[model samples]
Every structure is written in structure tokens, then in C-alpha cells.
Target: MTDGDLDATDPRTLPGFFDALADGKLLGGVCTDCGQVLLPPRPACYACGSRAVDVEPQSREGTVFSYTEVHTPPPAFAADAPYTVAVVELADGGRLLGRVAADYSDVAIGDSVELTVHEPTAAEREVALDYETDWPVHIFEPR
Candidate 1:
């Protein structure tokens, strides 16, 4: 199956994340009880085991917690190899994992960044989060 051909409605599918993306927003789950934040959010909190989770709009602004340059990506991401992957700590105390953008040579731990979504190309026009153009890819740019 192609990247865009995968089923996106199922929570088990990454495309389900795109459902939020299509609306030009990014979503993360927050525990209703303890207020712990989750990225690539879950229906239940890993911390307090609460099923009363609520969707939260993540802050686009964050600081780089850590990063690494991957010379080799998985088969699916091979085309975007030699990329920087980062763990960013959002201002609201959440974290997100994603690519750091092409011009990221000067990045360092604790650098400030803001999120921006990128639309998929026509060739990748599937109804998944990876294919949503209307939804911006939550990429980090220097702040």
C-alpha cells in the first residue's frame, strides 16, 4: 500500500492523527485528572491510568530537549534521510517528536522553536495525517 492508501479513521492508524490535521490543528491528549500531557496522545493517561482524557491543542512553541542526525531512516522515510529528529519540550510542558527541518545545522539543546505544519505533495494525497495539506505539519522552526 502507498503512504496515502492506509486507513486513517482507526485510532491504531497514524492517519487518525491526520483527522485533526485536516482541520489545521494539532492535537494531543491530556489527562483530565492529573493534567499530564501526551504527544501522539492516548485515550488513557499512562501516568494516572485515567480514561477521562481530553484533547488539547499543543503549543507550537517549544525548546529542543534533544536531537540526533539520522543518516539512515526506516524504509518509508529513506527519502528524507540525513535529517534531524528531535524531542521538543513544549512551553505548556508537553513534548513532541518530529523532524527538525532541513536548515537545522545550528540547532542545540534548549534552542527555542515554533511548530508549523507542512502539506503533503500531490503524489502523497491520501486521507491520512501524512497526506493532509490543510493541516500543517507540526515542524519546529527557530524561535
Candidate 2:
């Protein structure tokens, strides 16, 4: 699909995510009723079953919870294969999964890291997250 085809509404939609990314921010959802944090924020709380979720800014800081290096990605993301994918536990107790920009050999469980907003290049547009920024690609860097 073309960049123009990207949808920017609702966090669940790519377009909305990209809109935040273009602004260099990582947005997540929080349960207004229970104070539960949700990464990749949803409209409802998975824990308390509440629909009173609120948009909250997530901290870029986190620790590697788990990770794997994929030698092959699905057809669409084949180019990013052999890359490290990680589940990051944020400072606020939420978790998110994203690509680790660093070399897989350098990754370690529990490593400190911060969020980075990556800009979409033409080649990366297809699999680009809606949250990418116009600024430099954001990666979790060592603290």
C-alpha cells in the first residue's frame, strides 16, 4: 500500500500510530478506572474490563524482558529478518514489542534501553509503524 493509504486514526490503526511517531512520541493507553497501563494502548482495559482507557505518554526507558533474533521474517517484513525483536518492560510496568536496532549479537536480557522514533524511508514505508518520526530512527540505546 502507498504511504497515502496509511490510516492515522485510532491507535489500533496505523495512521494514528504514525501521527504520534512523526511527533517523536510514544503513546500508550492507560486504564483510567484501574490505573493499569497498556502499551499499544487499547480502547478498553484488558485487566479490569473497563472501557475508560486514557491515552498516556510512555517512558522511553525500559529493560529487555525477552528477545529473539529472526533469521527470516514473513514475506512482507523479509528485509528486516535476522533482526532482533524484543519485549521491553517499561518503567511504568507496561510492555511493548518492537525491533531492536542494535546488532543481535549485542543484545542481552535485562539491558537498559530507551525508546527511539524512527522515520519511514521509502523502502521502509510498507512495514513502517504509524508511530515513526520525521527525525532520526529511534532505537533503545544503552543508558
Candidate 3:
């Protein structure tokens, strides 16, 4: 998708992004100006402040850039305290933050991982806003 098609109804939007994710496709925005990749396909590039972002498929493969264990989670995630989370640098150049499917003890910086998507659990849906209730949740799995 090109910049001209980036509206509230396209993959650059949350609903459209989740829709594609639910179908197991990962899409990101490639900056025409500086080649920065934006997860969830935003209309503008955060790196160059350009409006030349183009939506494209992205690789699910990545490596952990940074990680930490979440011992103190928000109320919505209280049941899942002490979970592992990380900022993964994707093979396609986009970096995204997500829950890691592995334990904190099992993951390290530079660990290979793959992104996965799943429907929100009942508990997750309980805390989601009306528009986000059906959005797919993404997690990174150690590979």
C-alpha cells in the first residue's frame, strides 16, 4: 500500500493492522525517505518525519535487542506478572516491543526469536477498549 492509501481504513490503522495480523501476516511501513521500518504501518516515518511510508510485508524473524522481566505489571496483566518482555529487532529492520513466550531466565540479548499472533484471551478482552477487544496480541517466541 502506498502513502496515498493510508487512511483510518487501511493497514496503517490499528483495525486494519490487526485484521492482517489475525490472518497471520505481518506488515510494516517502509520509509521512502530514510528506509526506516515502522511496525503497524504508520502513515509517516518516525525517523525522518516524512509522509512517504509504504506498507509492505515484513519478516517474522528477529533477535532480541533488549529484554526484562515484568514483575510489576498493570492491573490488566496482574495474572501474568513476572512475564518476559523484550524489544526485538526484526530481520526487516523494524523493532517492536512484545511479550516473550519464554521465561526471563531463558532469554538473553541477541537471542533469535519469531513473532506470533493470537486472539486475545477472555481476560485480555475484559480490559480492552471497545475497539481493541478483537485485536490480535503479538508475542515473541524463542527460536
Candidate 4:
């Protein structure tokens, strides 16, 4: 779909991105102008301020760029506290932040990982807004 035709149902939008994720596909926005990759496809390129972005399939493989453990989470996620979260640099050049299946002590910079998607848990859905209840959760698994 063209940028001008973007809507909540468009892949460039969060809902659409998760919809594709639910089906096991990873989509990214490639900047036609500067080759920048946007992780959850957007209508415009953040690096070049260009609207010439195209949605395309992206590789699930990536390496840990950075990470941390959350010892204190919001009430909704208190049961899941002390989880590892990380910034992974994908094979296609897009960097995405997501939960890591490994523990903080097990993950390190440059560790290989692969993106994995799953339906949101009941607890997650409980905290999500109506429009986000159906969005899938993405995690990075050690590869």
C-alpha cells in the first residue's frame, strides 16, 4: 500500500505489523532514499526524512546490540519482572528492541539471536489497550 493510503490496518501501522507477525512474517520499512531499515514499517524514513519507504520481508536473525534486566516492572508485568530486554541488530540493518528468551546473565553483546513471535499472554492482553490486545509479542531467542 502507498504511504498515503496508510491506516491502522496497513502493514506500515502497528496493528498490521503484528498481524503479519502473528502469521510468522517479519516486515520492515526500507528507505528507498538512504537504505535505512525501519523495524515496524513506517510511512516515512526517520534517517532521511523521506516518505519513500517500502515494506518488505526482513530476516529474523540478529545479534544482541545491548541489553538489560528489568527487576521492577509495572504492576501488570510484576509477575514477569527480572526479564531480559535487548536491542538487537537485525541482518537487514534494522534494530529492534524486544524481550530476550535468555536471562541477562546469559546474554551478551554480539550474541546471536532470532526473532520469535507469539500470541500475547492473558496478562499482557489485560494491560494492552483495546486496539493492542491482539498484537503478538516478539522475543529474541538465542541461536
Which candidate tops TM-score? 4
Model 2 sits at a Cα RMSD from the real structure of: 6.4
Ranking by lDDT: 4, 3, 2, 1
Q: Where does candidate 1 clash, by residue pair?
A: 18-129, 117-136, 117-137, 118-137
Q: How accurate is candidate 3 locally (lDDT)?
A: 0.92
Residue 111's lDDT in candidate 3? 100
lDDT of 2 by residue, 3-88 (tens): 23324576645456557766877778888899889767766689998887777778889999998898878886777678888898
Candidate 2 Cα misplacement greater than 4 A, ranges: 1-14, 126-139
How many backbone clashes can be found in candidate 3?
A: 0
Q: What's the lDDT for candidate 1? A: 0.71
C-alpha RMSD by candidate, in order: 6.9, 6.4, 2.1, 1.7
Candidate 4 per-residue lDDT, tens place, 1-143, comes to: 34577777788999888899999999999999999999899889989899988899999999999999999898998999899999999999999999999889998999999999989999899999999989899999999
lDDT of 3 at 35: 95
Q: Which portions of model 3 miss their true places by more than 4 Å? A: 1-8
Residue pairs clashing in model 3 are none
Per-candidate clash tally:
4, 12, 0, 0
lDDT per model, in order?
A: 0.71, 0.74, 0.92, 0.92
Reference-based TM-score, model 2: 0.76
The stretch of ten residues in a row with the least summed lDDT in candidate 4 is: 1-10
